[model samples]
Target chain A: MTEFQAGPLSLSFGRKQVLHEVRTEVLRGGTMTALLGPNGSGKSTFLRAVAGVIRANGPIMLDGMNLARMSVQEKARYCAYMPQLLPPPVRMSVVEVVLLSLRLGGNYVGASAAMERVDAVLASLGIMHLADAMMGELSGGQRQMIGLAQALVRSPKLLLLDEPLSALDPRYQFIVMDALKRETVLRNMVTLVVLHDPAVALRQVDSAMMLRTGRVIASGVVEDIVTPEIMAEAYGVRARIERGSDGAAMVSVEGVV
Target chain B: MKERSNTESVQRALLCRRLLIIALLLSGLIAAVLWNLVCGASHLPLDLLLKALFSGPDDHLEGSAGVILWQLRLPMVLMSAVTGLSLGLAGAEMQTVLDNPLASPFTLGLSAASAFGASLAIILGLYIPGLPSEWSIAGNAFLFSIGSAFLLEMVVRLRGASAETVILFGIAMVFAFQAMVSMLQFVASEDSLQDLVFWTMGSVTRADWTKLTLLSSVFSAVMIWSFRDSLPLTALRFGDDRAAGLGVDVRRVRLAALIRISLLAALAVAFSGTIGFVGLVAPHIARRLVGEDHRLYLPAAALSGGIILCLACLAARTLVPGEVLPVGIMTALVGVPFFLGIVLRREKTE
Candidate 1:
C-alpha cells in the first residue's frame, strides 16, 4: 500500500500565515481521511500546499519518495487534486475535460484506452450519461461530479479533494462519497478530502484531522477526533456525539461555546 | 456496456463533425483567396490570371496581365491570408491564456503601439538606424511593437502572471499608446498627417514579397510551438489551480503564450499596419464551429481569420467599384455586426 506523509507545512500569503507548521500522521492507501475544520481553518490551503499547487515550506513524502524533489509533472503522476470551486461553465464537453486532465497529467495513453478509462470512471461515478454533455449546459451539481471524474480519471496514488461536495445535492453527496470510497480501495490510493460537515466526516471517513486557526488541533480516528472538547475548541460549538437509528456516530451541535 | 458504446459513438460523431467544419472552412478560405486574386481594381479574366499563375514570377510575360498578377495582386492576397492567420492564431492563444473572450492582439495594444511607432516615423522622420529609407517605418513599427510586448512580459514576470493583471495592464497600454499617437498626430504636417492616417487605416496594398516571407516563417514557427502546448492551454481554460492540479505549470504556460502572442501580433501589425477585428472575431467563430479543443480550434480559428481577411480584401476591392477602401475598415464593418450577433445569440441562449 502507498503511504502519504505531509509534515511541518508552513504557508504564508503576504503577512498572514494561512497554514502553520502543520503535520499529518502517515496516511495509508485504501483509506479516506477527512480534513475537518471550521471556516478559515486552512483546510483548502493545506490541500493546495500538499498538492504542490501552492508552494509551502515543508516536505511531502509519497511512498518514501520525497515529493519536494520531484517536478510538478512527476508529482502529478502520484497525486490528483480537486479544488473547492466548481469549474466555471466552459463550452467543452464533459469527456473532453476529463480527457484533458489525463493528457495534461502526461498520462499519454492511446485514444481508445484513454476513452475506456474515462468511461469507466464516469460510469463508476454514475455520470456516464454526462460524457457527451457540454459543461456549460450542466447544472452546478453535475459540474461538481465532472470535477470528481476528472480527478479520478488518472487514478493517481494520492487524491486531494477540497470540499468536493459543496455544490452537490444530498443524493449526489452520498453517491460521490461512496464512489470515492470504492475507488480509493480499488485503486489503493490515499484520499484526503476537506469536509465541513462533521457528521459527514464521522460517517464517511476512516480517519479525521481537526484544524483551527491554521493549526492541527487533533488527529486520529473519526470518533476520537470529533469529541466535545475538541469541537468546542476548534469550532466554538458545544457538541455531542450521538448514535443514530442506524447506529452510526453523528455530531450534534448544541450551541456556541 | 450499451451506454458506453453509445457515448463512444456520440464522441466519434462529434469529432467527425468538427473535421467536417474544418474542411468547410478550408474550402471557404480557398474560394476567398481565388476571389481576392481575380477581383482587384482592374479585373483580369480567369484564363489570363491562371496563365500568369502557372508561368510563375520568373518568366517574363509580354502582357500587362502577367505583371498585374505577379507584382500587384499576389503579394496583397498572400499578405491578407498570412496576417489573418497570425492574428487569429495569436488571438486564440491570447483569449485562452488570459481567460477572456474579448482579449486579442488589438485589445492587448500591440497594434496601437505599432501605430504609434509608424506615426513617429511619419511625423518626426524618426526611423530605426540601418534600415533603408523605404523600410524605416516598418522597422520602427516592428521594434516598437516588440518593445511593448517585452514590457508587458516583464510586468507579468514581476507581478503575478494572472490573466487579470495581463489584461488590465494591456488595456492600460492601449490607452497610453493611443494617447502618444494622438500627441504625435497633433504636431504633424498636413501631408505627414494624411500619410499617418492612411497607414493607421491598415491596407494589404502595402505588402511586399519580403514582408510576406518573414511573417510566414514566423507564423509557421509560432504555430508549431503553439500546437505543442495545445493540451496545457486547453487545461488552462478550467482555471489556474485546477490546471496546476492537472500538472500544467500555469505561470510558465501563460508566459510562453504571451511570448508567442508577442511575435505573431507584433510582426502582423508591423507588416500590415493596424488591422483590427479579425483577431477578435475569428476565434469566436472557430469556437462556435469546432468547440475549444485547441488541437482543432487553433487551425480552425486561423482559417476563419484568413477567410475573413481575404473576403475583406475582396470587399475592399469591389465595394466602391474603382476605389479600394482600406481592408482594415472593411473588417471592422463586417466584424462589428457579426460580433453583435454572437453576443445577442449568446444572450438569448443563456
Candidate 2:
C-alpha cells in the first residue's frame, strides 16, 4: 500500500492566509478521502497545493516522493487535478481532448495504446457514447464527466477532484461517485474529493477531513467525525445525523445556531 | 465485428477528407507560386519562363529574360512564400498559446516595430558601422522586432504570463511603434521618406539568395521545433489552468512560443516589410478548415498563408501591367474581406 502524507501545509495569497497547518494522510489501494468545508475554507487550495499547481509551505509526500519538490511535469505524472469550473466549449472532440491530456500528462504512450486507454477510461465513466461528440455540444454535467475522464486517462497515482459533483444531477452524482470509487479501488489509487453533499460523502468516502476558517476541525473515519456536534461546530448550524433508507448517514440541518 | 468495421470505415472517410483538403491547399500553393513566376511586370511567355528556370544561365538566348527570372522575380516570389509561411505559423501558435482567436504577429505590433526599425535605418542613415548599407535595414528590423518580443517577455515575467497581460502589453507596443514610425516619417527628407514609405508598403524585392537562405533556415528550424511541441500546444486550447493541471508548464511554453512568434515575424518583416493580412487571417482559415488540432492546423495555416501571399504578389503584378504594386496592399485587400466574411459567418452561427 502507498501512503500520501501532507503535514502542516500552509498557503497564502498575498498577505492573507488561505490554508493554515492543514494536514492529511491517505493510504492508497482504492481509498477515497472526502475534504469537507464551507466556502473559503481552503478545500480547493489544499488540493491545488498537493497537486503542485500552487506553492505551499510544508512537504507533500506520496510514496516517499516529495510532491512539492517535484517539477510540474514530474508532479503531473503522479497526480491529476480536475478543477470545479468546467472548461469552456472548444471545437475538439471528447476523445481528442482525452488524448491531449494523456500526451501532455508526461506519458508518451503510443497512438494505438493511448487511444485504447482513452476509450477504456471513457467507457469506465460510461461516456463511450459521447467520445466523438464535440465538447461544445455537451451539457454542463457531461462536460464535467469528460473532464474527470481526462484526469483519469493519465492513470495518475493521486487524483484530486474539487467539487466533482457540483454540476451533476442526483443520478449522475451517484453514478460518477460509484465509477470513481470503483476506479480508485481497482487501480489501487488514492483519491481526494471535495463534496458538498454530506450524504454522498458518508456513503462513498472511507475517511473525512473537515476544515473551517483555513484550519482542520476534525479528521477521521467519515461516519465517526461527521456527527451532529461536529457539523454544528464547523458550519455554525444546529444539525442532526440520521440514517437514511439506504443505510447512509445524512446530515439534517435544523437551523443556524 | 460489424460495429468495429463501421467505426473503421468512418475513420477512413474522415482521414480521406483531411488528406483531400490538404492536397487541394497544396495544389493552390503550387499554382500560385508558378503563376507568380510566369506573370510579372515583364511577362515571360510560359515556354521562356520554364526555360529560364531549368536551363543554365549561359544557355539563354537572351540575358535579359534570364536576369529577370533568376534575379528579380524568382527570389521575390520565393521570399513572399517564405514570409507568408513564417507569419502564418507564428499567428497560429500565438492564437493557441494566448487562447485568443484574434491574436497574431500584427496584433502584437511586432510588424510595426520592424517597420519602425527599417524606417529609422532608411531615414536616419543608422547602420551598423561594419555592415553594408543594404544589410542595415534588415538587421535593424530584426533587432528591433526581437527587442519588442523581449519587452513582451519581460512584462510577462514581471506581471505573470496571463493572456490578458500579454495582449495588453502587445497592444501598447504596437501603438508605441506606430507613433515612432509616424514621427520618423515627419522628420525624414523627401528621398528618405519615399524610401521609408516603400519599405512600409512591403515588397519581396528586398530578398536575394542570401536573405532567402536565412529565412528558409529560420522557418525550417522553428517549424520543426514547434511540431515537436504540437501535443502540448493542443492541450493549451483548453485554457492555461486546465493545461497546467495536465502537467504543462504554461509559463514556459507561452514564453517559448512568444519568442518563436517574434522571431518569425521579425524574419518576415526584415526582408519583406510589414505584410499584415497573412498573419491575422491565415490561422483562422486553417482553424476553420482543420478544426483545432495543432498538428494539422499549423501546417495548414502555413500553406494557406503562402498561397495567399503568392496570389497577392501575382495580383500586385497583373493588376497594373508594367507597374509593380506593393504585395502588402494586395494582402490587406484580399485578407480583410475574407476576415470580415468569417466574422459575419461566426456571428450567424453563434
Best by DockQ: 1
Candidate 1's C-alpha runs over 4 A off are: B1-6, B118-172, B189-195, B338-350
Would you give me the overall lDDT of model 2?
0.82
Instruction: Tell me, by TM-score, which candidate is best.
Output: 1
> Which pairs clash (backbone N, Cα, C closer than 3 Å) in model 2?
none
What is the DockQ for all candidates, taken in turn? 0.80, 0.62
Q: Write down the lDDT of every candidate, Cα atoms only.
A: 0.86, 0.82
Residue-wise C-alpha lDDT for candidate 1, range A128-179, written one tens digit per residue: 8789999989988889889988988888999999998988899888888888
Taking the candidates one at a time, how many backbone clashes does each contain?
0, 0
Model 1, B169-241: lDDT tens per residue? 8889989988898788788888878777766788888888988888899899999999999988888888878
- List native contact recovery per candidate, as a fraction of 1: 0.79, 0.67
Clash count, candidate 2: 0
